[model samples]
Target: MVARYVVSPRGGRRAYPSIASALRAAAARGRPALIEIAAGRYEESLVAQGDVRLVAADGPGSVVVNQLRGTVLQTYGSVQVDGLVLTNRDTEYDVVSCWQGSLTLDNVEVRTPGGVGTHARPNTRATLRNSVFLHGRTLFTASAGTIERCRFTDAADNAVAIIEGAQVSVRGSRIEGSRIHGVRVCDARAEVVGCELTGTGNAALMADTRAELAVADCVITAVHAEGIMFIEQSRGSVDRARVTDARHGVGAASGADPVVRDSVFTACRDTGINVQTDARGRFEDCRVVGARNIGVFSTKGGAPEVHGCHISGGNVGVAITEGARGRFTRIRIEDLTTTALRIFDPDSTGVFEDVRVDRCPAGLEVRGNGGTTAEVTRAEFHDFDQAAVALAGQCRVTLTGVTADRGMLGLGIGEEAQLRAFDCRVTRVSSGGAVVFGSARLIAKNLTVSGSEALGICGRNSALLDITHGEFTDCALVGAAFDDECTGRLVDCSVGGTGDMAVRHNGLVDLASLTTSLPVVRNREPVPLPPTIINVINIINQKIITGPTIHGDAINNNFAWGNDHVIQNQPTEEGPRT
Candidate 1:
């Protein structure tokens, strides 16, 4: 008893002039049927199966289902098209064609000239509320659906295409001029909420096989590519997204594992979060500004986990190379033009904590062509012009409580590098306070070089220094400098207010229990007591009760042999002795 039909192409009373004779008298009243249609052009081609509505007495732009050749509405079991205006002057077919039923378009208005503007076949299930798909190419391919408050403009390709066992839910959507992807999930499962995608030629949200996308609070702007692109083994999560002018404002590669939170990637031409091949992503509290290149890029063997991130103007403010591996925490890299964390793969390994590098010229730049390893804790390097921790090839680093301020060079262990510093601190370094050359190896503990204007620890070729409990204060020059053929071991060391010389051996230095209030030991070229100097410690300018002689061929039976057994030469007392 519920079958109402009223067509009216301007006829008399109980009108039924067009709408295919009121859908053939409401399909002979077999069950559910509405069919209203009254106010304008209707060069129709409608076909319905069971429960059909097709109502638009005088609403959506006053009814206009202008079809030329194929589909202008061809549903199967349950269809409902309110306030109609579905077009198609034959650009190649679809203008609403839901094959196996369940199609609902509320305030509908699909004007297709270049084809598909709603074609949900293959287990069809579509629903678009307050819809509007204008100059289309691909405006829908939903298998299971819900596109609320929809509006897709010049869509030439994918403007919501969720194939392969789909499960779509696009909320409060708005995709403008999409020449390519503006939401395209293949193996399918999408949930794009509060969407707003603008002028996308490619990747303004794209997920491939094994798909699982969940974009929240989105606003993807002018994207030519990658404003969210998770490939192959897709898995996505982008929250609080902004993503401006994109090339890569979120791009997870083949082995995709995307989880970008609190996102804000501005003017990105390239890497503003790009995890490569063996992908593993997790970027939290994100904020990557003007990224022209790397503002978080994990390469081939990708493994990213950046927390509390804030990378600014990037050329390289986090670029873990080819064999990528990363785990940075509390990171804050500033105005970078180059090198503010670049760990080139040797076998790639990075673990940074509490990092903060300001005005970067170079802060934490480890290059490894074969063996790389990094582990920095509590890092803070300021105003770097170069060398605020820069290792070369075959790198291996470990710095705890690291701090290098006003750097020109504060920690630059060259090729063949291997550094292990604990409680490190190099302040006001305009030049050097930790510089080991090729064949580098520096092992320091509790090292503190204060106000360095130059050399407060500088080793040359064959460099290798093992310092334990060090302190060199107010150094303007030499307070520990070993030249070519370098080799060292300075234990319980201390040199204060050094402006000229305080331990400047040519090479092979082994000083134990050394204490200098300030002055000389500039033995530039005379260290021929080789036998590896079993023990030779007497470099005191101040308080030394006695304990400095046990040279090769061991002879220390209680220090009482002064008959040429050499254990007594304590009379070179100079000024400034503490």
Candidate 2:
């Protein structure tokens, strides 16, 4: 026979005198029990030694349970607690702690004393739904648990920690006001979705040492340190998220393989994303802005895939250093005070291919002792104060189909550096044209320099200068000249306009073949022209520009170029050559 006990303060109730007596009577009956609690402050810890259901007359926050002792409810068997406000009476221990038994809680609130937990296991199991865990340290350290539709606040330590092959899931929650990590997965697999975390420590979500984490559709903000950290070979994935006001937004350390996509990091103090210590990662369709350090930093021989990202408003947009190799496609960096992209290799044996930049202080800044190879193609530069491309130390930099406007110096090459700028156009530059200062071999092909102050090609201690198949539209200075101790070879390059016979250099002028062909102009991209320029291309590039460009009107090219870059097709020559 099952026993039912109802306790109410506002009734002539002769059912039970106390809650303990009711529990004892129900347990003696050898059947399922139900205990109803009335609306009042129950400053007691109700222990569930067997299978029981505790129901409250009022909803959550009405029947308050204020516990000051160690653990609120110790579950030995199955227990169900619903619609209750479980508060801490300035407890020296955790407000609600569940042991190994299966516990189900709905519409509950677990509050602590605003102090750190002294024990290792502050709480365990602890499945909560539509609850609030507020003002606790080490609020949850579960062996296995699932928390959904909850809120956590004022936790100084880890809000949720899973260990020992535990599986934890937190969904649709708000975790905030933590000095340390919001959630840490150690030797566990955890999944978090549709949540927001703010004001945490080194990471909002951290996976350490053989742990795995998957985070999706979350917003992390106002953290002093990294928003997400993967360490000790942990595997993690972050998708469709936004992180703001942190140090490094996403950090993969110690050989961790993390995939990050469709994310945005704003106002990061350090690098927006960093891969260190042999970490392999992939980042796609991400935006990194307002960084004090680099936007993306890859170090320690890590291989990364950076695709379709707009990294701007930073000191250094991207830095590939310490013998790292990566493939970057359709990258754009703008409004940088320092180097937009820097590729540094100690041994100079790294490679950077198919990188692009626009509207940066310095589009490309390369420095290292290594002989690295880099290619910059189809890149546009605008409103830069320095050289669009700067090559220093022993490295090879190739520029093709690159355009720059109002550049201080088009290309700045240091000693022992090999540089090739081909099919490059520069407009409204006041300094020396396309090439400047080098001791290594230099080559310029089909280069157009217009409105510059100095020579088109100026070499200080260059070994060989090859100027071939070029057109100089308009220059404010001499077309192409080799300085003292510089050798030159001019083959089939057209030099039409000249700036001034300024500073006649004792070098040869090359005019191999003057060839004129009308430029094939077409509207390569769609443009409505924004009233205020919007940086929405990185998001769109994730969808469009997926293949090679074939013709003027390729069916699904879907490039969103600015209105100024759009040029209509010229009329074809139907009659004789006029």
Model 2 collision count:
5
- lDDT, candidate 2, equals 0.67
Per-residue lDDT of 349 in model 1: 79
Q: What is the C-alpha lDDT of each candidate?
A: 0.78, 0.67
Q: Write the per-residue lDDT of candidate 2 for residues 243-331, one digit (tens) a residue.
A: 99988889887888888999999989988988887887888899998888889888877767788888878788888878775667778
User: How much is 251 displaced in model 1, in angstroms?
Assistant: 2.7
TM-score of 1: 0.45
Clashing pairs in 2: 347-370, 348-370, 348-371, 476-499, 492-513
- Model 1 clash pairs? none
Q: Put down candidate 1 lDDT per residue, 377-432, tens digits, no spaces.
A: 99998987666877776778899999989866678776577899999898887666
